[model samples]
Target: MQKKLIDDSFSIVLGKQGLDLAKILDEKKYINEFIIAKKMNLTINQVRNFLYRLFEHGLVSNIRKKDKKKGWYTYFWKIEKINTLEFLDKEIKKRIYNLEHLLKSRETKRFYTCERCNIDYSEENALLNNFICHDCESVLVLKDNTKEINEIKKNIIYLKKELEEVEEEIKKNKDFLLKKREREIKKEKRLKKQAKEKLKKKKINEKKKIKKKTKKIKSIKRK
Candidate 1:
């Protein structure tokens, strides 16, 4: 379910080709762009174009490394999973809001339509037109909005479910990143402590060597 939302989100942004990209991009490690192009059976330029689109949306990230012998840079890309989910979340909310607004308008106000011309107008517009079809001179009929209202309600429900799933995925990704960061912090502290201990030991040994040299010089002077 989480994967579906991620894929759907990408597809929403870049179309069907984005679905193929969602499969290729790794979350943990950056994949070489050339390799991605090969895997997708697309030209390098096409792959870059897709990556650039995703990059604009913050759904993907990239790094470039200079090739020492070739003297050119190679790009690597990875999916920004949480960012994608967040984008999807915003899109779903926007859809729901629009649908709700439409639902309310449909329920409260009346609409008129010309059956022959298939043109729809709000009650106010119909009033201004004197309840006549401007094109065919036919009488305007009241539009039955029951079907539209029901369809809008279903769409709202579907989007809400999708939003919930996307939010769940976002939380999971955040928690994983937090734990990974904590582990890295712990490792860094341990390495620092070990380095401090090694330095202290080296200093103590150096001091002992100096003291022995001074004693030897004092004995030789007395002799």
Candidate 2:
């Protein structure tokens, strides 16, 4: 389900071609651009173009490696799953907000449509035009907004449900990242503690050797 959302976001941003690229890109590791191009049966430039489009949206990231023999650099790309999901979630929320506003407008206002020309006018405009189609010279009938309102309401419900799912995915991703970070921090602290213990033991051993040397010198002086 998360993968579907990511793919949908790619399709929205870069169309079908971007969706194809997203399918091939890895989330865990960076893939060589040349390899991606070969697998996708596209040119290097085409692949780069698609990657750059994703990059602009912070959906994908890349690193460049310099080739010693060729004295040039090659780029590798990877998909940022968390960022992609977040971006999709934000866009979905915006769409939902717009849909809600439209639904409200449909329910509250009156609209008139010209049957012949298929033009829509708000109540004020229809009133100003005297409820007549200026272009077609036909009568402007009051549009039954009930149907339109119902459709808009349905769309709002669907978008809200989708947003809820996307939000759940985002929460999961964030929790996973937090736990991974905590483990890394614990590992680092353990390594530092071990190093400190080793240093403390070495210092104690050095002090013992110095005390033995001093005692021997004092005994020789007494002799």
Candidate 3:
């Protein structure tokens, strides 16, 4: 379900082709462009273009490495899952805000429409025009807000739910990253402690060897 949401979000940003790329790129690993191209049956340049588009939106990340023998660079790409999800979340919020504003306007304001001309006007505009259609010369009818209001309300509800899910996914990603970082830090500290102990042992062994050599030298002199 999370994968579907992520894919749907990517598709919204990158179009239908974005869904294919989403499947090809891994969030955990950077994949070679050539490999991605092969999997998608696209040219390397085409793959780069798609990845670059994603890069422009900060949805994807890339790393380039120079080939040792060829001296040319190869690009590897990966999806920024958290960034993508957050982007969708912001978009959803914006839409919901706009829809709520429209809903309020629909509820509070009066609107008229000319059935003949199929043009709508607010009460202010209808009064300005004497409540008549300028082109058709017919009296305007009061517009019904029920359908439009219900539709907007439904959209707002759906977006709010989607926003909640996206936020949940973002939190999960953050927690996973935090735990991974903690493990890496613990491993680094353990390695550093071992290195310090090994160095201390080496110094003590050197000191013992020097003391033994000094005793032998004194004994030789006495003999």
Among these predictions, the greatest lDDT belongs to 1
What TM value does model 3 have? 0.88
Off by over 4 Å in 3: 38-45, 67-72, 116-118, 134-138
Per-residue lDDT tens digits for candidate 1, residues 58-120, read: 999999999999999999999888888998999899889999999999999999999999998
Worst 10 residues of 1 by lDDT: 1-10
User: Per-residue error at 158 for model 1, in Å?
Assistant: 2.0
The stretch of ten residues in a row with the least summed lDDT in candidate 3 is 1-10
Best by TM-score: 2
**Alpha-carbon RMSD of each model:** 2.4, 2.0, 2.3
Model 3 misses residue 85 by how many Å? 1.3
Error (Å) of candidate 3 at residue 60 is: 0.2
Query: For model 3, how does the per-residue alpha-carbon lDDT over 1-223 read when each residue is reduced to its tens digit?
Result: 6787778777877798899999988988999999999999999998888888888878899999999999999999988888888888888888999999999999999999999989999999999999999999899999998999999999999989888999998999999999999999999999999999999999999999999999999999999
lDDT tens digits, residue span 73-173, model 2: 99999999989998899899899889888888888899999999999999999999999988987889999988888888888889888889998999999
Candidate models: Cα lDDT each: 0.93, 0.92, 0.91
TM-score of each: 0.86, 0.90, 0.88
86 in model 1: Cα distance from truth in Å? 1.5
- The whole-model C-alpha lDDT of candidate 1 against the native structure comes to 0.93
Q: Ranking under TM-score, best-scoring first? A: 2, 3, 1
lDDT for residue 150 in candidate 2, whole number 0-100: 84
